[model samples]
Target: MNSPDIKPPGAEPAVKTHDNRRRWWTLLAVSAAQLLVVLDGTIVNIALPSAQTALGMSDASRQWAITAYALALGGLLLIGGRVSSALGHRRTFIIGLVGFAASSALGGAAVNPGMLFGARALQGVFAAALAPAGLSLLTTTFTEPRERGRAFSVFAAVGAAGSALGLVAGGLLTEYTSWRWCLYINVPIALFAVGGTALVPADRPIRGGGRLDVAGALLSAAGFGAVVYAFNEAEPLGWGSPKVLALLVGGVLLLAAFAAVEVRAPSPLLPMRVLSHRARAGALVSITLMFVAMFGFYLFMSYYTQTVLGYSPVQAGLTLIINALAALLGSTLIAGRLHGRVPPAMLILPGLIAAAAGMLILTRLTPQTTDVLPLYLVPALVLTGLGLGCVLPPTAGLATSDVHPYDIGAASAAYNASQQLGAALGTALLNTIATSAAASHLASARHATPTGASVHGYTTALTVGFGILLAAACVTAPLILKQQRS
Candidate 1:
């Protein structure tokens, strides 16, 4: 007689065959939505100068274009997650796509900076719903370990390379057409993603005992909003300014209150149990730290290629293709192939090491450096890309893996929150460091040329970023050890 634990051969084959047929379609749908959101985060960087010129906005106001999106997306993610669980993943995902498309169209038709900013913020609101719902769907849909690995490999690769791809697409559009096309382009992409959603499995919405935690949601949103505002203020007002100081303190206090509320709430917006797993917590933290370096790379590279190397926006965007290709290969081949064969840290640790080494290579830049591309920048970027590609897929998988079904949406949103906040913090902190370094060089030196000071500033800021990447590696190392011991 067959063992009680064994499934009938026919039964297993039927289930497996169905998943094989339907899984690829689901992946395509989710991936398209993800690309829409991730690409938007950096697409504007390339178009910012043109957008500012078109809208007659000052340098001081340019950051609002990015910050507004980050603030709304990051702050409201918890509510988005909870709402997705209450309504249903498939329904919320489609709604988000539609909303995002409408906002993109609005932004494309903007007559002023205020219009553009408002549109971008609305785009973030929809994305807050779309991103987590897509991730949670992937988490629940792929039950088999191997299939899950492959799904996440594609998802993470697209996510890792989306920002680089944005630079390329943004440049081509801005140089050849108009900056408005960058926003308009998302309409087609989102509409296409929405069309594909019919193939995804019909997921049941959470019901009964899943009441919204109104107080917890409010506290978290307000707290995160304040923190995001403080970081934006720090770019121009200095870190120690009273406005920045008050916001920082208030944000922290509110967040502390949020934690207290979560622990007591009957239906917590972020159920404490979702964060109880050590591996999941570690994965979330690692994702946050990695993006700190990754976003800084994107921000600095755009300026460096344009201002220092005298490359046009199109040329600068093309240069990033090398990095994107490396990342794509590493995610599919290295991380994808090793998914079930080895421990995740086995991939993540080496990836972090390679990324940190790449940053060290970048620290060699100077005003006298003429061949930045052929020699230093290309190889360094490739290394960073490979490392990130290897690291991101596995960590993302871990963040939502093995969670209770109802909590998956919240788990996915928390991961996204970590990434968005990391990007905001990295952009603000690194920009501040670069600007301060340049000013100090001018003040202290007897004969400081603008080129010398600028290059010095870029390198100094990157050096700090390098150290942060190393710190990230250190953070992951202990978690790996703990998992091994257990």
Candidate 2:
């Protein structure tokens, strides 16, 4: 029989001497790593137009720039998570940062579209490694409940604000400098983070005794990759295309297989225990829904600003500052205060409702309308930000709260995987819906005018986006509230 005092097969050993100062420094390093990962998603978005022009990319290939990163990051996230458990978070984190910075430099200097896409994929691969490792590091670093709460609050705030910050930073870099700067920016950040990591103490190293869930990893990655690819192709190809149908079917089968593998494996890639708690499951669902609305909003708003409102890259970036600022304020003040006092569900419900309302308001924007005319959107943006701030902290807190210390890496992996999948699905689905709506509107436009068709399409897309957010709210409300009541 196993010794009762012995650590689990793959668990990290506890630190001999816990130093609070060193831990905080470690948190900074981890936070910096996370910011780099999240920021890459939107930062490149702001540079898409410039990259296209510079590389002379065809319209057909433009989406690949974004899709490549999402597919790689989303596909490999579970693998990254398991790797953290099999290896150690510190080793994985440093490795990821180094790889990501190198990839960023490659993308920045690329002269062709293919090279750029390759670099983006490389970046995603490393991001998948870095993101989960960062979260896992946070989970292990703060063992005390009070300290954990404070640590998560800061982490959640950064997650909420990172995208908007990316937009502003991307805009500034792309406008004043070159689009290459967007990719190049990670170099310095990663270097600074690496330096901090050196000063921070490493977690108790894992003994190499357990095997990787290779079968599970392949199935989950491929399954998710296929689903995302199907959605992406659905826009360019009709829904009935055989390729899309086959991929969709294959993806479903693979995911089912992954579930089967998890059940029988000696050490599951995703342990069932990580998701045993009602509050944790509810939090994951809430986060997924929130991203559905948030991702769609960003995609549409970026297009509207550039194509419809005639804003330059810099102006487009500045417009998002309002949302970022509000997110920072809300997360810092409201989210932190509400934790442990009110049920997390109570905070999540109103937040989802507010976001849905904001999306509803945005649906009314027209091509001819000035940004000032839709000033109502500012408050709505704040509402969306506020809602996100409330949901993220408590949800993150709850998800990892009950996890076994040995499985903290897996828990972090699961959380980050859900987030990436949500973003991918949200972006793909919303883009498809918007594209379809645009085509339909164009076909039925007043005098077949380009501007008129574009306006009608954008409005229709926004309307559909609002409906999606409402549906997300409906799903989140019950699960979270039920858990809260129980």
Candidate 3:
């Protein structure tokens, strides 16, 4: 029979004593680690062209660099989380940080496409290890509601700002320095984080009877990898293509099989109980849906600003800083302050509505609209950032709240994985929708120029994005409201 506390074999034992004074420093270390991971997600985008040119890679082959990172990191996230529980948080964190830094160094020094791709994938593996461990550390460290909210607010603000910061940093480095610096930049950050790890409380590894569910880990990782790869390929190859269809189908089948295995296994890579709570489940779903809008928005906005508005990479990056700043204020000042005082649903619902309205504002954009920055883009970006800021921090806290200590790592992994998969799905599905809309506009319109068709497609996609945000609100608002009432 399982004990109430269930110190399963892979679960780490609780620390005997915590250094209360050093907790804030620990948060800084974990936050820095998380910032590095999140920043890497978008930092490579601006540098991709330069990297490709340096490595002499074809356009078709170039995506492998990005895809490799996503697949490895996203797919292995659960395993990494589980491993964190098994190995202890500080150990996992340090190992992950070191490995990640080394991989970044390797990527920075790459002389060929293969070397860069390999290094990118390796970076992903270490990222998988780093993210959940950091989050779980934060979850375990800050248990008081007020302090937790404050902590998550800081973490969420950093996360919200990281992608935009990545754009600016990438642009600066690519233009003024070298693309290699983008990867090399991670090394110093990682080293600093490693040193910061010394302040963290030591965790004792859980040693007991349960064995690792190797099969469950394999199935889940492969399933997720295939799904991410399918979505990625869907952009280049039509959704109906055989390769895409097979991968999607196979991925689903593998995931289903993994579910069956988890039900019967003594120890699971992703314990079903971690997702059993209504709040946690709702949080995960909302996080996924939010990213669906966010990832698509970033991709299309980059295209619209650069292709239509004729912004330079640096200028394009600079414009996004508005969104980042807005997000920081909204998350840390607005949402963070209101966390315990207000019901989460109240904040999230209005935020979602505001975000939808913001996306709707984006629909007014066109090639004829010359004052794009002031008239349409800035307002929309600010609104979206505000909305997201309200949503992310609170929901992130909810994601791990009330979770079992044994399952904390898995819960964190699930949250991060949802964001990753959501981004991949958004990028693939929305891009496809927009491309098809453009093609149809070209074919059907009476006086359709390429520019007009493209803009029309972008607006059409933005409309869909608005609809998605509304749908997410519909799904999440009721769940949160119901929780509040109960």
The C-alpha local distance difference test score for the whole of candidate 2 amounts to 0.80
lDDT of 2 at 85: 66
Q: Please give the CA lDDT of all the candidate structures.
A: 0.87, 0.80, 0.88
What is candidate 1's CA lDDT for residue 377? 90
Better of 2 and 3 by lDDT: 3
Q: What lDDT does candidate 3 reach at residue 320?
A: 88
All candidates' TM-scores? 0.94, 0.89, 0.94
Question: Which digits, one per residue and each the tens of the lDDT, describe model 3 over residues 1-486?
Answer: 767996766445333234565678778999899889989999998999999999999998999989999999989999998988889878999999999999999999999999999999999999999999999889888887788888888898888889888988999999999999999999999999999998887886655517888999999999999999999999999799999999999999999999999999988888898877777777888889888888888878788878777889898888889988888888889889998888877777777888888899989877687777788998999998998888888888888888877888888999999999988998888888889999999999998888888898889888999999999888987777787688
Q: Which stretches of candidate 3 lie over 4 Å from their true place?
A: 1-18
**CA lDDT for candidate 1:** 0.87
416-483 per-residue lDDT for model 1 (tens digits):
88888888788878888888999999889888988788888888888988888889889877876586
Q: How close is candidate 3 to the true structure, as a TM-score?
A: 0.94
- lDDT (0-100) at residue 391 of candidate 1? 87
TM-score (C-alpha) between model 1 and the true structure = 0.94
